[model samples]
Target: MFYQFPEDFYWGGASSALQTEGSDSSRGKTIFDVFYNLAPNRFFDGVGPNKLADFYHRYKEDISLYKAVGHNSHRTSISWARLIPDGDGDVDQEAVVYYHEVIDEFKRQGVTLIMNLMHFDMPAALQAKGGFENREVVDAYVRYAKICFELFGDKVKLWATFNEPIVTPEGGYLYDFHYPNVVDFKRAVQVSYNMIIAHAAAVKVFHQVVDGGEICTILNITPIYPRSDNPKDVAAARIADLIFVRSFLDPVLLGQWNAELVEFLGEHDLLPVGLPEDKQLIAANRVDFIGLNYYQPRRVKAKEHVPHPESVLLPESFFDYYEMQGRRMNTSRGWEIYPKAIYDMLMTIKNEYGNVKCYIAENGMGIQQEDQFRGADGVIDDTYRIAFYKEHLRYVHQAISEGVNCFGYHIWTPIDNWSMINAYKNRYGVIEFNPQTGERKLKRSGSWFKELVDANGFDD
Candidate 1:
């Protein structure tokens, strides 16, 4: 490989609480159940999150697989329901034992654990009480964060407060893709603000309590590209970027929200409600780094047709999404394949957000292939996935060379894990698992990744 990453460069894989852990009910209810039960058709194949990868039982075996694949670091989330059954009151003893064992086993295997405190798994018990929109939910989240820091702070050095906190407001509240499906911009802004406060509160507690741990927030940043060279389209792209990417990154990293976003919210009368001290909390608890999960770019243009003047207004009412023509796309998930977006995102973080230390925390393609382990060879020739990883990684190398504070690369998952709605609908794993029988098999890409790690680069 021409672009050799730095020595001691971390290479790993990432998974979430609701996606891989199968013991959803072993502790308590979560927002996943609320969404699925409300609208089963929204999920791919109509499968819920109950039957995840069963990592709760098979994690010991899974960590060994991580070693086989040359992963020195592994990222996984702790389930809130598992820790506090109702997301507030008492810590579950069973969950504490299981997670401690998992962390210790990883240490025994010489792998570093990057633990995320929450990953969209709001205990359904809390959602029934208004979820993040309610102030009490923020207090519950702070308590949960405190418990994790106190319990696992010694072993876990890298702590992520929340994984894609903005997605709840964007996908769940404003777009109706998740539970408590309400399409209200005002409510979305309120939820987004609350999540930021919750994150700050968690970070404050982590710093106050956890002595030697570092904390960061994960954002699934989709770089926005203008449809054409038209200046109006360019302005629209900037607005979209301000709304989607900078909305959270600015506050978390720069210690304040973007002025453009604040002004836009003011124009719409959707400015978030915050206590006077909330600003002080956010400003005080700035993160040490950022975890950028870039998969694709968002193509945008100015809205061409204005809605009826008398109609009810929404965010979409002002902007129209204009997908760029002839852009590369991921075939299975139908997501636009824009590897360059990763480089652009890093550049933006460097230029606009003060060049904070960050990493490609989650990036991978989801493939729908059934014959991944169909032969006596027990090997999957996942050439497409290999290509996806290499192309995206090339961009990371380019960004690193250009002075982006890029640290490491963690693919979306290590093994084929289950998703909340789709339930193993797509595969983005280096290691392919027979979800039916719990058989672990390394795909050809897994071997390729191991060589990449061993050689410190891909040789041409």
Candidate 2:
């Protein structure tokens, strides 16, 4: 092996319950279901989150695929709607049994199970009263977290409170890309603050209940860069980083919000009113580790003009997105392919933060029109995906060698599953899923990943 990892380094892939598991009818409705039902046209191909990859009925087969891929650890989330149905009500006994069976099967296969409490799938009942904007919803979420720790904490050692906590506010509140789409900057800030508090509450409960279990939250960290060395551009990038990256990162890791962020929010009159004990809870319950989902870097320049007084306020109002000329891009998914960003992110966490333990929670390429790559043997020859992983892993390996405390690397997913809004437009999985026939086939990247995991690394 050209670059070997530590003996116990985790090698696996990730999935979310709402994206993979089907049987939506049995599970209670989520805010996503309500949103899709209200506006099915908003989704690509008019496909909502119904009967996704059917992981609910096919988890045993999926676990077999994980074993075949040489995965020692797997990251997935539990569906709150499936588990508790109404979000704050009696537990669904069937859902509990199913999760236990799934955990036991992973243990039998020698795969470490990493379970997440939430992944952008809040129950519809909770969202009816303003989702995270309502303090009652925060208490409901804490209750759900407690139930999870009590029920399955023994089987799952690694638990994440949430996945990409920023997405909830950004997509739903600001961008109108998710459920209960509301375009309000103040609500966005409130949602962000409430989520941080909820995460702290979950961490506190995890510590109180789960013995010998580690708790963390997953963040999609994208280092922002200025278009030039100009001070204004640099400042724009800095502010963007504060809003997107450090807003949640600082609070979860350091147990306090960033000073600059607080000042900025206060200046704009967007600061959320903290609960009496919110500060103390956040200060007391910090995470044991972090899970970084890095894909691209954000390049920004100073805004060309000031926004009108009546214009909607946003972090982007102070900065303009700049696309670097001649940079490589994944045209299929319309995202920049910057492998070094992972190295930069890991280094930032090490230097700026306290060098906390971390892992590559979700990182992979999503390609459209993948069927064209199928060869005569009927196998998808996704060599581009292989190259993508190799490039990113090289940077990840560099960071690990530099003492970044990054212990694991998991791809975005093990199988192609349904994505929100985009539906099944882009596929980011080692195993190809045939939606027409419900069959699974290992792509070339799957075979390559198996080899990479088995050897711990690959030769140049």
Candidate 3:
């Protein structure tokens, strides 16, 4: 079978600002910087945000490399901390000029650049004042969004509000892996609620400012699977899906909170403090599309035991993770390699979520220390990466064929970039990056991708 894709389909990759752009152009401090300062050892090799893939200095060359590697479209972020120092302060003229040049470069190379507003990289100045936990920070973020729209909207028609926004509150407040580490359930709820408001406010502002641009949110959607056909396991899976997936999905696409989620939170006395007008604001500003970042599936089961009434509460307090025996796993990242979950997710979107226009924002395998796979000819023989893409793309094609509104497929990244805590431990890129000398080389997967994008499909 000749597995073909739709005409005008977007074919490219996705990345973020702080992950790729090293601290440059008078960039202000970010939450990652603060975290590294507090606990440098937590990150791989003790690498920090200040040290990155150096996209800030090497974007021109890197863009050329991505284009050559067959990227007709790409997704990346505009650093809020870089553009407006402190998140709501003086606009950095140097940052402005730098971003302008970068966007122009993408246009010059005939690549569509989708600029994301935030990717868990909040400005430290705003974060210091409570980050998303503080209502004032929501306004600051909206203002930042407006500035980005007016500045880059002319050249960049595609924009995203946040990339995997759940990680912000989930990591920082619930798990304490991020800066401003706090383990308060109420605080986490408040942070997530504020982000919803912030996203809606930005959507409202974008329509008011930008004339002809499409704005969306990038959500990391992992399909939840029940351990068995038992009702308790199914219930656990449903609630977990509600908490992780629908929490943001409902608000952005349906323009309202999941009713069951709200009632459950209220019953548990865990609802975030909000205003009546907040609902109206959210209801009025739904996104134009969605970018679903699928990496793995989550296997869940009913709580193995009742939580102590006096103990602190968490999402896991109601459910337990189920490790399936003989499940296909990615040893490099410890994630399940279930490509069909992509099809299941898209079907759910079509059946339940109004079938919103969407695309595969990020789907790639991360292998640790890929340099060990390099051949004598200076090429990484990453046949595994190519096989991984083929498997996932087949599912993506199946979903589109069945009318799931999936428009494109973008891998996790175009080149090796820094990940939070992991740094560059797991390389998820078609192109390799040399951190020290800023060198790049096309891997075996890179050559394969160029052909795949050029043809818009591959044979089965």
All candidates: CA RMSD in angstroms? 1.6, 0.9, 1.0
lDDT of 1 by residue, 65-97 (tens): 988999989889999998888888888998999
Itemize residue pairs with steric clashes in candidate 2: none
lDDT at residue 332 of model 3 (Cα atoms): 91
Q: Per-residue alpha-carbon lDDT of model 2 for 154-188, expressed as tens digits? A: 77889999999999999999998998889898999
Clashing residue pairs in candidate 1 (N, C-alpha, C atoms within 3 angstroms): 1-458, 1-459, 29-124, 30-124
Please report, in order, the local distance difference test score of every candidate based on alpha carbons: 0.86, 0.92, 0.92
Q: Candidate 1, overall lDDT?
A: 0.86
| TM-score of model 3 vs. true structure | 0.99
| lDDT preference between candidates 1 and 3, better one | 3
When summed lDDT is taken over every stretch of 10 residues in candidate 3, the lowest stretch is: 16-25
